[model samples]
Target chain A: MNDQNGLTIAVVGATGAVGQQIIETLMKRDFPYKKLVLLSSARSAGKKVNVGGNELIIQEARPESFDGIDIALFSAGGSVSMELAPEAAKRGAIVIDNTSAFRMDPDVPLVVPEVNEEDVRSHKGIIANPNCSTIQMVVALEPVRKKYGLKKIIVSTYQAVSGAGNAAIEELELETRALIDGKPYEPKVLPVKTGEKHYQIAFNAIPQIDKFEDNGYTFEELKMMNETKKIMHDSNLHVAATCVRLPIETGHSESIYFEIESDDVTADSIKELLKEAPGVVLQDDPANQVYPMPADCVGKKDVFVGRIRKDLDNNKGFHMWVVSDNLQKGAAWNTVQIAESLVNLGVVKKK
Target chain B: MNDQNGLTIAVVGATGAVGQQIIETLMKRDFPYKKLVLLSSARSAGKKVNVGGNELIIQEARPESFDGIDIALFSAGGSVSMELAPEAAKRGAIVIDNTSAFRMDPDVPLVVPEVNEEDVRSHKGIIANPNCSTIQMVVALEPVRKKYGLKKIIVSTYQAVSGAGNAAIEELELETRALIDGKPYEPKVLPVKTGEKHYQIAFNAIPQIDKFEDNGYTFEELKMMNETKKIMHDSNLHVAATCVRLPIETGHSESIYFEIESDDVTADSIKELLKEAPGVVLQDDPANQVYPMPADCVGKKDVFVGRIRKDLDNNKGFHMWVVSDNLQKGAAWNTVQIAESLVNLGVVKKK
Candidate 1:
């Protein structure tokens, strides 16, 4: 309410999980915005949300919604973003999309500010955010990649249900209660809500996260593999991912095994490197039983890493566990950080 | 009993989790036995467990209690087996010990019947069962190794609470109920019941399983690493493990990435081989949404394999998911299968 002389910002998908977080994050970071426009689909247009002592009614998102907006944050479904992002950019608004719509587009720069902040300079009105699983991993590994030169990576994720959406979280909670009470519970929202088959995620682990590709990799797994290379600017890097959904609610945890190009690299050196890396917290004290866990990392912005150890056979290979909030650093905080980077780089000027 | 000419089998620690499964498996498999003896520690000595509709009293396990027994199965704690396993063996009873005390011993055989049944002939009275996680993985990989020659393996495990014991399962049930009810719950049994630290496993994933070794790998992780090497008889194979505990109650799932010695192998060939491999079921079908899940694998004795795919960058590398009932295949069924192998190999006489 006090930034009356700043740039105008609009938040699309204002009622969704990441959208709500984006609003909170904008307020938390004291984002320089003269007017914050809240927009959503027609189904949710009339909802009201309180923002810093001002009540804002959600409006149906349209091409005209970006009329005078300087920076529009789009996090609705991928189709909505695919349709609305270019229109927003056409109207002179820099759209930071939180969907997978324009991520792999040659014109769009997929940015993780800590890893590739300068890539924002090349954004064609729409800068893409990487996948939640990819964001935490690349943040933890960028320092090592910059120092030792990474050659390969194999990651298996223990992802929370919140990564699926709000309905999936509700399904986990409801199904867990039904199972605990010895009542029949039918799953209708996991492994992909619109997918044909549904699996119980309560007290169980589902190996599939999204629709499968022809090559047998899930879309989420492919995102991790592809997004890492794009953000790091290395097309030749070796990466593979197995993303599995767990009973967790918010954080995404990964077991990563990687090989560096140099043979002299040790786990200790990597630990020391991550200890000083930005947006990364090293939590690898096994003696005192200190390590990052999903429950402990909920709502945190920093990527927490622990259990760093060198492979017994390969001196160049190292293993670590990384955990972070999927909704925060993986989605909201990272998006807000990109906006801050835009403001710092003078991509968006204060009016 | 009907089998008047069959062997006399004694079950030590006959009241614990694996012991209960051992009894049920024997009944389910119709194991040939004349006199069935049940023995436990002094604390559980007067308890009664019905076996095949016959009430059997649990006697105190001692050196003399194993007299005239043809085969003895031990699933008690390590110290209990360290003290009583040798006693059972000295009384002319071939011992099948489930504790880790004698697994690495040069004179004892660590047997998974499907992987290395011939290793039973060298057993000097005690045949050891491998850890739950190790048993399922080695079973799934032995066929792969024999056909294509595995050179490297990196695994991340999604384990169940029952792998710890029956008490840990109870703790999961109680803690999950508390969390669902929005009440406070304390973790007293997970990661390691007696270990210094406890973490919430309800709606959370705990990376630490068992105590952390000096090298930063948990003891459970070390078990997966060491046991895989020993079972496969490849001391130089490169293996790394990140063992994690989830809230699942029965099945343990593993995401395994492996490099074969040959570069011409395809994902289809691996699936074809596992489809016919003993004690392994291939459940990979992405088109029909068929894959191995923890809930579906409960009460199953066979190891379920799915999601087989080739790596995008490495031609010789492959990834797959393996799941099995931890209590059955990982412990009781594997031990009973070892006994059946002994009977088939003519090592144990039924006269």
Candidate 2:
């Protein structure tokens, strides 16, 4: 690693699912990090993890943990970010947050670098990663937005259980096998497990992803709406999201409908733009039945998009299917990418 | 049984998946019949099925098979329906075709008795059952549309693979298990297998249901668009559908966004109308985390609806989810319901 450019990176909540992926992504991308720090809660602290062939011991995340860290990646939770993210930022570390804590904050820049990489420069201290469902959709839609100009968006997601957490994914597999074997299993971690009730995700579709707000939108829906506007810098863009958790174990698939600003925009033209778009892999050969799938997107970072078509009557209306590994591009890779961007933009300094 | 009202009933394609459900639905509903006839291909002709504790042998379906039949319930493929449906109708028997053969025919009435009981009388000789995806959405939305006029409908379906027939369901289960086990299995029946290539449906989403039509919409999407207009008798109403085959086995789920003519409509008002509507089961209780799931609706005859919410900033727009067993309400039960409607309305006579 070059001493002049390499920086020390700290991964908060390294033992967690998304946190583990963040470490793997950083290693797979061969990010230029001079040193790496792994931090978790007190319970998970002292555990050891194997990342990119290196065995690293986890330590408890504290306010003083960011003393010499050049970049801190946070995916513990919203509470952890609210408590420690600012602390790490105040210590002169560029914080890349994968929680909802700073996503809606006016000062934080919610970024999907391909969609809003320039916004990263304007961030005061923290950079927020959009929701997993929103991340894939924006990646697919940004290319279309850039070429055609987006006016409105309506998205219905077929999200995997992994987006909820690792336990939800395990629950899906266990419950599915139980149902196959004619055994009854109670659902304890779906449709917001912390909420009063939980719904079964075995061959079911749950419409409420997060708790409903007073304005009638679920917290997850609000994240897509608000985070999308922030990342695209288009508060006036009309966006409606119906987030549903399916029985899938990993990856998230979304049926996105959008109205472009141009009248003569065709599905073929949008397909061409996405074919050349960054972080996007077009799998839309309907003749050969090649389209995106969550099962196929597991462990992948690129957003998979297909089924691009114009509406029958409305010339400006279009529909597309967006899919990506929720744990990868949605959370981990995006955080690691932010770290990479910090070095590339010379925003991080070694202590 | 009263011989005067009793009619000779024939179930076509009696050995197939939907055919078996149609026979069971008829026997369970105690359909009026002087004699029950089961007809299939020559391969399944001698097979005997127990219907309501009675053993009925399947006979080969031929044009003359409808000679003594007073009514015919056809679950055969579209090609068989095209060949045998009119032949039975010409033999003085009312033919209820479950295939897409006569669905879009101007002379044929597509009926979901609950949605359009009056439309049943307009059937000249052949009646059509709407697509499985369309049947559930219209059944849930028609009640609200009747009270308040409907202007536009946009539906994105999280459809079950069972709608593609029993073979696709088997493929999904097999492929899913193979997927989890890190094995390779050939996909033979998904996303229109015969039309082109096949993709694994386990933990994946395929946007193409039926083959691509002349327009960009898949055949399944086009069927929903045209069938809704025919069944509701609303040629002017705007309808758009994006059908995706999920890995689920039986029940089909749809996310429908519709605009009502009245501007003062509320979500509560729509729920009230659906609660009292026929063949509708309101499972919406977001406060207590009660909503409909496809796994729970298996073998059910009624349409299950939940997650009803009004669109923000648009008083006339509302969104709801509709789910039902595709083989039941979407096909067999609806076919028998039309048979019952014919008997109740004196559209068919046994002398």
Q: What class would a CAPRI assessor give candidate 1's docking? A: high
Q: What is the per-residue lDDT of model 2 for residues B1-351, given as tens digits with 9 covering 90 to 100?
A: 325558999999998889989877776776678888899888889998887777888999999999988889998799999999999999878899999999999899889999888787887889998888889988998887888999988889998888888889789878877766779999988888577678878777778898986456789999999899888888998888889888788899988888899988788889899998899999988777777889889999989988888887468888888889999999999999999999888887655
In candidate 2 chain A, where is summed lDDT lowest over 10 consecutive residues?
A342-351
Clashing pairs in 1: none
User: What DockQ does model 2 achieve?
Assistant: 0.61
Give all candidates' CA lDDT scores.
Answer: 0.93, 0.86
Task: State the lDDT of candidate 1 residue by residue for A184-292, as single tens digits.
Answer: 9999999899899999999888999889999999999999999999999999999999999999989999999999988877778999999999999999999988999
lDDT of 1 by residue, B230-332 (tens): 9888999888999999999989999999999987789999999999999999999998889999999999999999999999999999999999999999999
Worst 10 residues of 1 chain B by lDDT: B1-10
Calculate DockQ per candidate and list them: 0.90, 0.61
Give the clash count for each candidate. 0, 0
